[model samples]
Structures are given as structure tokens and as C-alpha cells.
Target: MTRRTSTSIGFVAVLLWALLALFTVGTAPVPPFLLNALTFALGGALGVSWVTATGGWHKLHAVPLRVYLFGTIGLFGYHALYFSALRLAPPAEASLIAYLWPLLIVLFSGLLPGERLGPLHILGACIAFSGAALIVAPGPDGFTGGIGLILAGLCALTWSGYSVLSRRLGAIPTESVAVFCLATAVLSLPAHLIFETTYWPAAPAGWLAIVGLGLGPVGLAFYVWDIGMKNGDIQLLGASSYAAPLFSTLILIVAGLADPRPSLLLAAALIAGGAGLAALGSARAQRRLIK
Candidate 1:
């Protein structure tokens, strides 16, 4: 595929993750470990099947050990901390904090060779942070869980580090996602056995959410995201990623899991506007450089 096409597909891939968060809302009855175990396990199976069908299985063994190791750390670490945070903090607040990874990406990307942090990038990131803060800041009832907030921050740090590393490792064939997913499953399963009770989702909706998470976010989403962060307009992706939380929060409201509030609308506007300005600036800079 052309670079543009690949990058466009990557944007779609990131957007799919928003849906993953949405589905998790419906699967609340499933314990965090069990929920993650099922999602990653099924997702691993699908990734393997896809790789096998595509004739990439032969190359899997050739993937560097570091790739597998780092992928496992990045993928497993983010979810583990994120899920744990959800149990302790309000999901909405926890998610807003976890979503800090995107802005972190914007800030961290500048440290990479050849990436620039222009005025618009900084402005956009600040705006997005403000929007998230607005969502996360407690109303009359202040946030009670300090540990949860810390976990969420760690989740952001872990995820941002992963994203930057993914760009460096983007040269690895995307099929290696099969390896990553399987590793996550192998790791998570034991954790579930050791610390958490293993139970399957009993309700149809819960099962559907698990299947959706496996297929979309945990499975194919990673495949697309790997390609995108490696080759796509990553700055644009990072700037736009602020929308994921907005979308997730909106989905929770629609699902009746979260109460509707004015902050939601304001947060959406700030995030959307900031992302728009950043993306527009990036496009302009690209045009100027091309000229």
C-alpha cells in the first residue's frame, strides 16, 4: 500500500480502540484479569490465524527476541495497570488520566530524530491536557483514590513509551503482532490463575464484548496501529488521539454507565478543536517543506 493509504488505515485502527473501551463498559461483570485474559487469548488466536493464512508464519521465528519482549511489556503493562486503575478509581476519571499517553507522545516524539515540535503542537497538547483535566477533576466529591491516579499515570507513561518504541520497531513486519498477542496471552493467563478467579462471561452481551475486544482492539487494532505509528503522520495521530477518551466517555453516557454532564460537551470541543489545529498546522508545515 502507498504510505498515505497505510497511514489513513492507521488512523482508522486507532479509532477502533475507542470502541474497545466502549465494549469494556458492557463487560463489567467479568473480572479484570479474566476479561483481559479472554480478550488477549482470543485475539492471539486470531492474529496467529491471520499470520498463518497470509504466509507470514515462517518469518515469525526470525523476529528479534527484543521485539517480542518489548511488545509483551508494552501491551501487557498498559492493560494491567489500566484495568487495575478502573477498579479503584471512577472509570471516567481513570480513563481521562490514562489517555494522557497521546499528549505524552506529542511531547516525546520531539526527542526522536527528525521529529519537530512546533508552536501548534505545544498549544494543541496543552489544550488537550486541559480538556482531560476538566473531565478528571472531581466535582463536589473529590477523587478518593490516590493509588488509582498513580496507576493511571503509570499506564500513560508505559503506553507512551510503547508508542515511541513502536515507531523505532516499526521496521519489524506487522505480522509480528501475532507473536505479541500470543505472548500477552501466555503472560496474562498465569497471572489470572495465580491471583484472580478464572470465570467465563455468562451473559451474551459480555461474550459479545469480549469477542469484539479480541477482534478489533486487541487484535487487528494493534496491527494497524503498528503500521500507522511507524509510517503514518504520527503527530496528527497523537493530536487526534485525544478524541478516544471523548468518544469513550460519550459511549459510557449513552450506555447509562456514566451520567451526562456539561463537562463532556466542553471537553469534546476543546479536544476536537485542539486536534484540528494541530493537524492543520502539520499539514501546512508539510506543504511548506514540500514546496
Candidate 2:
């Protein structure tokens, strides 16, 4: 696919992730690791079905074992670290730190072989991060530097590193994300068993939400994201990822889970402006390449 097409597909993952908060809310009472296990299981199943239908199982065979290990670690390590961070730190602070992945991705992409980190990209990422901060910033609870904060920082690094490294593995088929999801599910099961009390979805909506999480955010998001990271405008994708939290907050407001606030309006403007700036930067780069 063209770079533009791949980037658009990658942005679709952000849109899907916007629904993550809503679905997680719907999945009330399900602990984090257990939720991870369930959603990833379904995500893996979705990938398995697609691979079988397309006779793509052979494609997976060519993939190296190390790649599998890397993918599994990336997928599972992110959630494990994030959940652990939240447990030790304030939720708002933890989330804010974890959300740094987008900014980190933009910064790290500069280190990649062909990628250039334009000023606009960095500026846009900072502005977008400020917008996200407005939403997830701590309230009366002040910051405390400890293992929790360190873990949260690592959470950001893990995801950003995973995304940036995926670009180097461009030849790796997106289908391998299926194995990543499956392996993540397997790993999550043991983590949940060890750290969490088992609890299934109590109602049908909860179950449906679990399925939605699997099919959308946890499932197809990873695949399209792989395509984008591998061949699309990585800088633009990183900068634009800030929109997931913005859209997610909007979804929560519309669902009556959150009240509309003045800060949300300002945050919306900031995020939109940042994303637009990044898009301009990406377009300029593309034009330069074509010339």
C-alpha cells in the first residue's frame, strides 16, 4: 500500500483505541490482567481465523523465533507494566505517564534509519501532550516519585520502543501480530492467576464489551498499527496518537460517564491544532521525497 494509505490504516487504530475507555468501563469489575487475558484471547482468535481463511499460516512459519519473543514481550510487557504502575501510583498520574508513549514514539522515530524528526513534529507532540495532560492531570493528590513512577516511565518506553522497533522489522508480516496477541494472552493468564482474583463478565453488556475490545482495540488495531509503523509516516502517526485520549474523553462525555467541562474544549482545540501541524509536516516531507 501507499504510505498515505498505510498511515490512514494506522490512524484507524487510534480511533479504535478511543473506544477503549468506554469498553473498559463497560467491563466493570474485571481486573486488569484478567481483562487482558480475555480480550487478547479473542484478539488472537480473530487473527487465527483470518490467517486460516486466507491460508496465511505458512507465512507465519517463515518468521523467526526471536521475533515472536520480541512481539510477545512488547504486547504483554506494556500491559503488565501499566497495570503495575497504576496499582502503585495515583491513577491520573500513572495514566499521564503511560500516555507518554506517543511523544516517545515521535522522539524515538528520529533515531530510525530513514525517518527525520522535523521541528513541527516535536512541537506538535509537546502541544498534544499538554492537551492530554489537561485531561489526565492529577487533582488534589500530588506527585510522588517512587517505583510506581519509574514503572510508568518504563511503560511508555516499552510501547514506544515496540512501535519504533517494528519499523526496522518491516519485512515481518502483520500476520505475526496474531501470534503476539496469542502469546500475550497466554502470558496474561498466568499473571492474572498470580496477582488477580478471577472474575468473569457479570452481564451480557460486559461480555459484549469484552468482544468489542477484542475485535477492535485489542485485535485489528495491532495489525493496522504494524502496517503504519512499518511503511507509513511514523512521525505523523506518533503525533496523531494523542487524539485517542481526546476522542476517548468525548466518548465518555457523550455516554454520560463524564460531564462536559471547559478544559475539554481547550484540550480538543489543542489536540486538533497539534495533529494538523503534524499532518502539514508529514505532507511537506512526502513532497520533498517525491521531488
Highest lDDT scorer: 2
RMSD of 1: 1.9
The whole-model C-alpha lDDT of candidate 1 against the native structure comes to 0.78
List ranges where model 2 is wrong by over 4 Å.
81-98, 132-154
Q: Encode model 1's per-residue lDDT on 1-291: one tens digit a residue.
A: 766776787777667877766677667767676767778888889888888788987777778898899998888888888877876776766777787787888788888887888898888877877886776677677756468878988998998889887888766888888778878878887788889876666789878988998889888888888888888877777777777877877777787776677876677667666776677767776677679
RMSD to the native, candidate 2?
Answer: 3.0
| Candidate 2 lDDT over residue span 202-287, tens digit each | 89999999899999988999989999999888988887887765677677778886556676567666765676677667678878
Task: State in Å the error of residue 209, model 2.
Answer: 1.1
Give candidate 1 misplaced runs (Cα > 4 Å).
144-146
Q: What are the RMSDs of all candidates, in order?
A: 1.9, 3.0
> Candidate 2: which pairs clash?
none
TM-score of 1: 0.92
